[model samples]
Target chain A: MKTLVWVEHDNSAMADATLAAVTAAGKLGEVHLLVAGSGCRAVAEQAAQIAGVGKVHLADNAAYANALAENVAPLVVDLMSHHDAFVAPATSHGKNITPRVAALLDVMQISDILSVEGEKTFTRPTYAGNAIATVESTDAKLVITVRGTAFDKAETTGGSATIEDVSGAGDAGLSSFVGAEIAKNERPELTSAKIIVSGGRALKDSETFQQVIMPLADKLGAGVGASRAAVDAGYVPNDYQVGQTGKIVAPEVYIAIGISGAIQHLAGMKDSKTIIAINKDEDAPIFQVADIGLVGDLFKIVPELTEKL
Target chain B: MKALVPVKRVIDYNVKPRVKADGTGVDLANVKMSMNPFDEIAVEEAIRLKESGAVTEIIAISVGPAKAQETLRTALAMGADSAILVETDDEVEPLAVAKILKAAAAEVQPGLIILGKQAIDDDSNQTGQMLAALMNLPQGTFASKVVVEGDSVTVTREVDGGLETVKLSLPAIVTTDLRLNEPRYASLPNIMKAKKKPLDVKTPADYGVDITPRIKTLKVAEPPVRQAGIKVADVDELVAKLKNMGVA
Candidate 1:
């Protein structure tokens, strides 16, 4: 049986998360990374470098760059018969297309999977991050979206696989990328980061936010995050917002400052290996789940802590 | 312009869902169901758009068992002009729901379709995009603000790294975020009025849409517990513990 891992990219360059998905797909069967995009030969070459990959199937085209399920779903559906299962990182684009492809194939799609065992069973989180559940996908064709943060990224070696071009689907014009303004980030992607520093509304304003949160994250080489309240207040961007409605992140060490720990916010980060909460309120809900709770005002604590680090 | 908003019935957000004793799924037996909080925001945005006169009609759609009608009525009571219930007892995956909505969108032919970015119960954040994909329409996901100008609409979207704006012509799909808008409570008079509004009942078959579980759930188990570490005072102790754990 062959397992296909979807590779995302700018068509010429492979995304780090896509490589991680290929590394994860290796556990199930001979991994074949599906590089879909316009001029995707580079993506195919990079995917081939991952140790466990057996082949690189390149579906190169302009339509792949502005991937809408309309164009991508049919292609995956057409190729489904050749692969026993499919996996992709649980990013926004992957989440949008994978389920539709699964539905088109009339099979189950297990999403946000964290671990895999054998060909049928996988483990994933539930109730936000409150509980973990093991699931078995007995279907002949299993479709899934793996949480990119859960696995190690694949490293490059000096070998290339045969690049095969595939064609079957065309854009149905469901949606088009009019334009995209990528957020500039100097640090690693939040989901892929090993360290993360987050702040809540208690930071007061953007200036204070920059003073306290940004430097902490920078010192720790961590991604910066904000609570929904902080984001809504315009202290940070929506992408920086971490909660049930925002990004789900799990890092090696998560440091939360001034967050009162709403269940919604906790749902996003409770999976971290270690949680450290800094809040003035001893009764703050975040302390209940934090591996280390510092009972002090973040205003004073953050500045002092930053100096030490 | 007419607008359509899709709603999902889910376990009340305030009521924490629990895995069942048998481990089949979250225990929903006798659980209080409500309009997903995010969907409520979508309804609020749709109604606000209609009230602003940019829209002339507001129709709400929900795909689930008959009980989902209650959620639809809530939208109606909050000022939706009409409601459509696509009844299905099985777990209708997000993609199938999007397909069903695509057919419903064809039938309604609304100028705009709004949905919550994600359903808290399943956290599948796919319907709005899938509906757009299935219908071959433009979409803006995780929209924090939506503005309509002439024949085009601009949506401010929240992405992983920051905020971005996307523009599309009319007949676009917009998914709501938590901060989109605060929903209003239905007044008693409006609740009574909702009973008189038209609520069309239908099924996936009516729209020629199939409700299939694309992803099989093999098992549902609890997430691993995090072992508690000792509390540390001062930076030295904190560093010592982190170093001991090899995490610093």
Candidate 2:
């Protein structure tokens, strides 16, 4: 079986999520990476080095500069004739584009698979991680999105894959990119961060959420996350949210401060390797899953912990 | 311009779903059902557009069991002008749902089609995009903000890193994200008024679409349970435990 994995990148370096997706694709069959972007020969070179990649298909065109689904989905669907399955990291770009490819291919897509059970079956979370469903696809050509946290990252180097330039499936002329307001942060991206410091509504407001969570996150060299309550309360931007409806992170060490740990919130972070909760409420649900629970005031405890660390 | 907003009736967001012992599926015999929260945001956004005078009418639609009419009534109560219920008993996957919506859009000829990014039950996050694909329309998924001008719509999307703004020609598809807007609750009088609104019932056969399940569920089970660990006495002890575990 030949599997084509879409490489997520910024026209230069490949996103870490793609490496994890490569690992998932390796389990299915020989992996071929598709680097579809403008001026992205650097990204294609990077994709060619990941371990287990057999070939890298490069589609360099101005129409793909923004990775718009209208433009990229046709490109992927056009290439589906040569492959059996299509795999992509379940990032925003992947989620936005893969379904279009699936619809065009007249196939059902399996979204956010946690494990590859067999050639056609997989396990995925349902009802916001409250239940796990094992589903087997009957589609002749499979399209799948892999959750990065579920698989270990493939080695970045030590592979020599042949690069083949593929023609771009020209612009679809449906949508056009206007502008983007991407937050510039020095901290690691939340999904790829090894450690995460998450705050909750109890942080009071945006000012306090930052003052308390930022120092500790910087101390631990971790990504900053917020419970849905915090994001809803205007304590932080929506991008900082970490929950079922928000970004899902499974870091090595997760520190929850002032988080009440709703089922939706736990759905995102319960998979972390180690959880530490510090909330004044002794009976908060977060403590149930926390590897280490500290019952106290977060305002004081968080600062003190940051100081000590 | 007419706006079509798709709503779904799923298990309430607050209710924790329990997998059946026989591993068939989630037990929903007597579960509390409500409109999917994301769809509520979509409905709210459409109402806001109508209030702003950009949308002349708002029509809500849903494809589910007959009980889904209650979900549409809720949308009507919230401010939709009318509704359509594509009644079905079989589980409709995203592709089929998109196809049904595409057929419905042809009959309705709405200027905008807005829906939830994903339903809470399946969480597939595919319908709106697939609908856009089948209909050959522009799509804006995970929309946090939407602005409709004369012949175009601008949508601000909630992407992984931050926000991305895109411009699409009118008669486009926009899916709601969490940060879109807080949905409004229906007042008692509005609930009564919703009963008098127009509701058209149709089926998959009416749209010439086959609503069959392409995926077979072998089993459904609970996620792995996480065991709670010991509570530390103070911050000092917490730091010491982390060091011992080599977490820092």
Using DockQ, give the best candidate's number. 2
* Residue-wise C-alpha lDDT for candidate 2, range A83-175, written one tens digit per residue: 999999999999999998899998999999999999999999899999999999998999999998999999999998999999966688888
Q: For model 1, what is the alpha-carbon lDDT of residue A43? A: 70
- How many pairs of residues collide in model 1? 19
Q: Which runs of model 2 end up more than 4 angstroms from their true locations? A: none
Q: Is the docking of candidate 2 incorrect, acceptable, medium or high quality?
A: high
So what's the TM-score on candidate 1?
0.90
Candidate 2 chain B has its poorest 10 consecutive residues by lDDT at: B239-248
The candidate that achieves the highest lDDT relative to the unseen native structure: 2
After the best TM-score superposition of candidate 1, give how far the Cα of residue A20 lies from its true spot, in angstroms: 2.9
Q: Per-prediction DockQ scores? A: 0.43, 0.86
